[model samples]
Target: MKTCLVVDDSGVVRKVARRILEDLSFSVREAADGQAALVCCEEFMPDGILLDWNMPVMEGLEFLLELRKRDGGDVPRVIFCTTNNDIEHIAKAIASGANEYIMKPFDSDILREKLEEVGLIEKVDP
Candidate 1:
């Protein structure tokens, strides 16, 4: 199964994302912040990452920059999951190497669609 890391400060957000990712057949891992997520990546690179914008320790953009610098880091499909919906934030995320972006309060379908859009998953029947 493909592996996914869900990085968020909120336990509830992490739990919800874990469930959706699990349903999509991804082996999921959770991290409370970008620093922790980076540590997790160092141990074993995941196939994809669902990252939040704001958190303690390191922020998502900083982590993305650092992650892209590592060997094999370019391979993971990164999707920024956050409440930041402004064009500037979205543009920055895309430019920083995120494969896609999803707003907060996402449901399984929205998450699944974003994954599909990024070519991380095959299309599923309704």
Candidate 2:
């Protein structure tokens, strides 16, 4: 199973996202902030990351920059999940290597669509 790391400061958000990803058959891990997320990444590299923008210790953008600066096998695909909907912020996320952006209060269908768009979700033969 593919692994997904969820990075958010909100317990509720983390719980909901974890449920969603887990139900979709992805192994999920979580962290409360960017700092903790980095530690999780180092320990068990995930195939994708759902990251929040405003986090304690280090923000998502800063974390992305730091990851980009490193040389590794394969940089995990990242989806920015946040309340920040400004076009400039969206542009900045893309510029910083985010594969996709999902606003807060995300709908499950939209999240599923994003996973499919990134080739993370595939149709299963019955």
Please state every model's RMSD to the true fold in angstroms: 0.7, 2.0
Indicate the residue-level lDDT of 105 in model 2.
Answer: 93
Q: What is the lDDT of residue 84 in candidate 1?
A: 98
Task: Give the C-alpha miss distance for residue 36 in model 2, angstroms.
Answer: 0.7
lDDT agreement with native, every candidate: 0.95, 0.87
Number of colliding residue pairs in each model: 0, 0
Q: For model 1, how does the per-residue alpha-carbon lDDT over 14-92 read when each residue is reduced to its tens digit?
A: 9999988898889999999999999999999999999999999999999999999999999999999999999999999
Predicted model with the maximum TM-score: 1
TM-score of each: 0.98, 0.92
Model 2, global lDDT? 0.87
lDDT of 1 at 99: 95
Model 1: colliding residue pairs: none
Give stretches of model 1 more than 4 Å off.
none
